[model samples]
Target: MDLGTCDDSGLETGSDAFLALRIRIETHIATIGIIGLGYVGLPLAQAIVERGYPVLGLDVDTTKVETLNRGETYIRHITAETVAAMGATGRFSATVDFDRLAECDLILICVPTPLNRYREPDLSYVEETTRAIAARLRRGQLIVLESTTYPGTTAQLMAPILEAGGLRSGSDFFLAYSPEREDPGNPQYSTAAIPKVVGGEGPEALELARLFYASIVAQAIPVSSSATAEAVKLTENIFRAVNIALVNELKVIYDAMGIDVWEVIDAAKTKPFGFMPFYPGPGLGGHCIPIDPFYLTWKAREFEINTRFIELAGEVNTRMPHWVVERLALALDQRLGRGLSRARVLLLGMAYKKNVGDLRESPSLRLMEMMEGRGAHVDYHDPYIPEVMRTREHPSLAGRRSIAWNLASIAEYDAVLIATDHDGLDYEGMVGAAKLVVDTRNVCARHGVSGANVVKA
Candidate 1:
């Protein structure tokens, strides 16, 4: 219990304390491994290596492994230089091998926690990865679940599978849940700057997990239990989902009242306190915000309690894509003297957000599919994403093509729908050229686009 420190002489001290201290020090210096080198994992691995920890990045994608091994980054926000530097220092490496999990003392799971067609939490990736980790489970190794999930996932689902390898939690090994708070394209917060929330099964597990995150992160917030930590992540996304639904609802109301929602928001934002702005868009996109909230809602149903706000928000946000199509149809009817059918509709951007190339759950795709379904000949233009895989929803659209930025050609489209507002997009030229514009984002309004040509949603 003394936990003795190393003396200047480096000799054995009080009782068996020196031996115990040596074991602890050895474990502290053990290798760190990260699974899934996407937006969440790559930054975390880089931050861990920057903290002078030997880190291994494991991904099922061979291309990702190849890219990382060559000191390159496939992700837009992550740079090749960082990977190169880490590789040069011999502290970081990536592989597709599952067997290498045995070499890592601390393993962080950052795999995708996507929802299935039924909107049920698809935890297959987490389960398979847990099985892989359990295969290599060793005494004293620490495992942290970084993937977002329902409240009891770490304890009820992952904990048992991890313990299957003849290891007991808090005794033979440590397990914790620290959801990844990755905000891609944010200039202010890097992986190291974000305060990590960690909670383990018990006191010993919690302290060890706290120490592990504290080695790299700015701060570690230790919660009561793993379920609380999981709930914290869900609460963050659910808050956004509900607030975004509020703004989306407001956008509908303001549009009906002939009041510019963006203008109203800009005016409201002038107040310093008691107000934080959440913009209305075509719909919710990206991996986290649109999906994580539903995981909690799904779990909440088992308690026979309804999550009205969460469901309402999801309903409102989901309807926006259809509403965007309606706006486009109306814009075309007024300008071209016809319905949306055979109207050459060109979508502005395909990526979920403004600048990033991530397209998971992108509402732009849904809008395009809905437009195509309504007999509008739809084409998309995203500089970041040149080709999009055809989904079951949009099977007729074989693939997507990037729209040429030429004013003459861009003007050919009957209506241009701005789904995403990328920074480099020529908003002025687009508004000037396009005969009819449906701006789901407030890009056209911000650029002072005139009436008769532009419509805001």
Candidate 2:
């Protein structure tokens, strides 16, 4: 850990630094430091630790550091046993201190790249994390960015800050970008199973990054530049956002013609080659689909080009929560002889997606706010999320806990709205208990529990 000598036992400097680092990485002796210890970084740390490399996790959040140090986890899909196993390896540790970053041979930034209030790209987290890295920049160390952002972020924004320390990138130190593709609760694709698309500032940096990732993941695809790799991540998420908007628009149009959109989609997907099925939901949720596409939208404006298709998709998706509330009101008037105003409504599933406790940018929060704005008393139930944590978008809804699941609890509401279709819910019993069921996800029909009382939005 000494920084004074030019030997392998100490820190390498001059022309031979990159070679020393390469040898350390190839031999699985380099200590990898991950900046964020949330969903992406924790799983990534586990993958590297499994490959016989020591990991040092650095985060500003003391709670996350403490939790991981104690062999516990805050994420639902990543079990406590996984965390305990990481600790058992004696190769994994988390800390809130930034000074310890210099001890690592390679540093990976996995922080959030969220949108601001205007829906523009807010790179504050990335910028701040980069400045911190620049302060402790050292030779023979490689820095890789895994957060999703617009093109040119790695070279245009990060390179200058790092070089200000008098060390040249791709020579004195190393820099690369490899967008994270972590999917929470997905059993089919673990962190190691997903292939990585990595791009570096130069050939040396790219080679180092490719070699580092190849040791852990299934495959490592090396691109020409960092911007191209950044665009790859945006393109993947934007494709989903646009297609989801298409199905959402179709759902609204088909409902007017008394057609089941899900059934139509099921039939259309049989075409095999041309058609790909994208389901209609109450709204878009999660970290990527709802926010990542807009990073490109904001960036495109800089080039004087308009992304009309992407913008329209955003509009269509955002309007879904309001349309769902309107359907609930109409269903109540026609079936129960009552209005949405002063009605007791139960919203099922508080998480963004089913079977996971991630609630970032969840449409369910917007739905609850809209329903409550219409004078409806709202409560929710999610087996994954027991209590609503404080979110920047929905601060007032904090401290609200999920209601108990039972026949008596279900019968108390005037209507039950299925916002998220988590599996293993007693759909048939719910249909029998509630006076009305407004299903946005068509879970009741999918479960073969349908009646005149159940309505699809």
Candidate 3:
């Protein structure tokens, strides 16, 4: 176990293709290709470039590629200066060109793997990306899938597609699965600092994957197999989803009993032992919590087993938007003497989480859609999202632009619903101005705007 006694004896002997790929990796001269210049891939590319490794980014979106190539960042948290600095290093470039995929020595897939309408695993992005790699596959190159998916995805789906180039996987080429740990808008954690989990199908693939992530992150945790690595990511997300759902349900129960859930949580969290505080909201937000747990549920069905906790959590979380609107109806009627039918509701914060513009599966959108359906006029204000687009998932609420909020604008609304508590905003002013504030986030409670003016949903 001595650090000085560590050697390369763990790496298995393989073909010339494997040996040359290993040499390039160990020498730090290998070009890194990142498919998908997204929240995950962009940070990873920046980290590699900072480490003195040249990186090429490939994406299907021409606009994103052009923006990155122009040294501008479309994401809010990432600055243009950082991107321009990386571009100036002459080691970073983003493109829509798949033909240039052959130029890189190691490739990483960081695309989205969302669930379809039936709530099944829609791995279209991973499938399409692997096929593109298959077409351009060559010897002496290593590929890694960093997309979060179900177990056996790297070996069952990607390995065969990558082997279609007349090259056997783990022999002529290396393939591995390493889950991405990118937490957007978190100032404390970055891609370069977070620990990585790496696993592979063979000994050679495992060693290469472990070493590759070791260069990027603070520590690389090597698992027994590729499927276990994938499962580890799922377990991390499912824990959050279930715990959040429990708190959301308790928020409802505590309200019914005339006890403040926020105050209860404040008291419970003070113990600081065998307890972790998970706050309630209108619903679950972000790409991981609301969607990723279902991947395990779908995969578990193959063994004729049902994931009851995941299903129950999903049901409870999904009911939050409707329950929130129902509570808003009661609060609005009690304050203004009218139902939701002509209520002018203003929603605060549209992003799934605070301070990040990512709206994937954001429950605030569902709250807006529900309010609008009930004969209420809904408008939103998010410092992050300037305008909502017509995505295939939530196209009904498209083309809505964020309205600037102030004392005058706040008084005009019949009610204000605090969806996400983005910091640095004047919460005191909004709580003081709005007549009946239905706070789904507990921002008002913390700000001391209580009594007849605010109702904690």
Candidate 4:
């Protein structure tokens, strides 16, 4: 018989061939467990469950667990029907139990990595989750981090924590970094439709992650290392931050020149190539665009390299709230012949972006806080968010109502500041009613209300 031909008796005797078969078995049919059932994790858990895999979602928030158990979705994009269907199928559930993590063959950590008061990268949540995962670390399990953070976090910080449990990465347990790309209120891209980027510490970890993500995501792009995958997410956000800063800066320049920035952009956008439009707003907000790039800037300090562009972008963006307030003050002075002090100013729309109730890092909050500091009697009207959040920085203002689109309330305020251009708000009616309007969002131009009464920033 030829040497290449394997006899049935010889195959049974070969021990090396049996090891390969075991590896194949370990790679397939893995139960997925997603930690942190927030915007990113909950949808991912639902998507995995929809793929016919049993998924366990873990969160420390008892209220979120109760909501999930009752088939309710707190996030805007996620539907209650989807959660109910997943729950009815018995394929998805959430708990605060960390010990049960070992039951899952694949564990995805989707915890929040927020910034501290000093604008520094705060990895406390990530570290706490790592310790919890380490407690129940097991062999043959794939662990992937899906949080937006700086490069080398997965391999340098998280890998050591996982290894502390006496399991070797790439040999016993697999480790990878795959950032979450969740854009709330975007109808075009769903959780399953967005392309995922994955990288790992080694070849085995990389292959396993790619295969697993391929099963759920439409496409998976693998990079050279876990650090690159982390960098990719930062790069995407940093690009946006820089572009937004550019437009915000241009908004100030165009306003001085008595030219509408929105009109200039609309005219320039006619060119099909070399220009992708990034609009000017009151300021930048959301979890990723305003926070993620700073993580990179913080990490770059270790190498003694200054991320000047990112630093400048952050400075410009941070100054936008003050700029908007200054513009409002100017508008009030021009119209009512008085200072911002004792002037009744009303802010429209508190949520950062249009059509979403998420107010995390919203510029509107900062703008309102700055107005309050300037002695302006600030009252905001956001139909989506009834009560304004009371943080240590901004004390809760009592007796504020969502100002109905009435001509009386519009005329009462010295100047109305349009912070967020939500679709539900009546832009035309507000323009018609208000004595003076400082449109920071450029929403006034959309309604063809461009005259001396409206000021575009």
| Top of the candidates by TM-score | 3
Query: Would you list the rank order by TM-score, best first?
Result: 3, 2, 1, 4
Q: Per-candidate RMSD vs. true structure?
A: 3.7, 3.9, 2.9, 4.4
| lDDT scores in order | 0.84, 0.93, 0.89, 0.83
User: What is the TM-score of candidate 1?
Assistant: 0.93
Q: Which stretches of candidate 4 lie over 4 Å from their true place?
A: 1-29, 390-408, 450-452
Q: What is the TM-score of each candidate against the true structure?
A: 0.93, 0.96, 0.97, 0.91
lDDT of 2 by residue, 1-103 (tens): 3434464433243446777788999999999999998889988999999999999999999999999999999998888999999999999999988999899
What is the overall TM-score of model 4 with all chains considered together? 0.91
Candidate 1 lDDT tens digits, 126-210: 9999999988887767789999999999999988998876778877777899999988878789999999999998765676678
**How well is each residue in 172-226 modelled by candidate 4, as lDDT tens digits?**
7778999999887777888899999999888667777877888788998999999
In angstroms, give how far residue 252 of model 4 lies from its true place.
1.3
Worst 10 residues of 1 by lDDT: 12-21
Better of 3 and 4 by lDDT: 3
Give lDDT: candidate 2, residue 228: 95
RMSD of 2: 3.9
Q: Give the Cα error of residue 12 in candidate 4, in Å.
A: 20
Provide the lDDT at 335 for model 3. 82
| Model with the higher TM-score, candidate 2 or 4 | 2
Better of 2 and 3 by lDDT: 2
- Most accurate candidate by lDDT: 2
lDDT of 1: 0.84
Backbone clashes in candidate 2 total 0
